[model samples]
Target: MWWYTFAHVVYHLIRWFPKNNRLKIRIVIVLFSFGLLFPQLFVLSREHSTRYCGQHLFDFLIVSIVFTFFMIGFSFIFSLMDPVPWEVKLAFHIFGVIAFVMGLTLTVFASLAVDCRNNTLELYYLSVSAAVLTVTSFAFLMVMIPFWLLNYFFPNSVLNRKERTGVCYEPTACCSCLWHI
Candidate 1:
């Protein structure tokens, strides 16, 4: 739906950004998408809980989703500097990927377990739908993060940084930096 549209936009936009900022932007988008999708999972859990385990699981999901969304928002707002080191970028990317995978796995497993008790098809559908969305979002994030990181860390290899800074068009052929432009 609209999420796919947003993802597509993000995908293309990442191509134009400097490499280092690309990963950061993807991570932000992934976090924002997670925040956007959490409510659907919460509502599904609420409707299908018959046992105490279901309630516990629902509570756990709510807490996890809230905490994740908070962290993503905080990180996005705080990290504005350019050329983040490779190690820091890798760490964030790894953390986000692991968290996303684990969360989706847990949701799927819990949904299947609940389905056993309730014999309801809706639970299965909800679980599968959530998994699909989670996977799609994560896949987009994976592509964008690495692409941006490569660009940022190795700008000269792929893009002409001098041209981007407007130094190539100078008429005087001066050795001065592009800051004058």
Candidate 2:
């Protein structure tokens, strides 16, 4: 479901440009890798340490969102290759790098400083940051979606059903029949 949602959003966001379905897949994989899977795995595997430096579960969530933005920003920068002019692409890439670093630095600092006595202010700022990213990421994800099926957005034609690979059914589908009441 998350993969579908991401694909839909990315299709639209990248539609104006030439469709490199492979690149889109790669970008989504990268996004989910850094944004969702990595963090979840980190928290689950790490024995629930409460130390701020160790990054509690909540801090991992924040870091996940921060990493998602970084992934999106980098993907966007990469998508500009060959299509956009060199000067503009270079400029945007530099800006994207700066933004990624700044966001990661700030989020890491918040995660680390969360144990400090003056932490109310830190948590408040992190909450505000999280909220802002939450909205922007969703908005941009929507931006990322579908101009997919719409042909004007594509450089090449969409493939016909017969032209594409056939859908394969799982053998496990018959095993489920055995359990039916």
Highest lDDT scorer: 1
lDDT of 2 by residue, 1-181 (tens): 1222333344345544455555765566466545644544444344433334433434644554555554455455444443556785465446445544544445555455544424343343443454455445445535433423333455223322344321111222434221110
The ten-residue window of minimal lDDT in model 2 covers: 163-172
Q: Mark the regions of model 1 whose C-alpha exceeds 4 Å error after superposition.
A: 1-60, 75-97, 107-126, 159-181
**Per-model C-alpha RMSD:** 10.2, 15.2
**Prediction 1 TM-score vs. true:** 0.44
CA shift of 16, model 1, Å: 11
Count the clashes in each prediction: 4, 7
Query: What's the true lDDT of residue 69 in model 2?
Result: 57
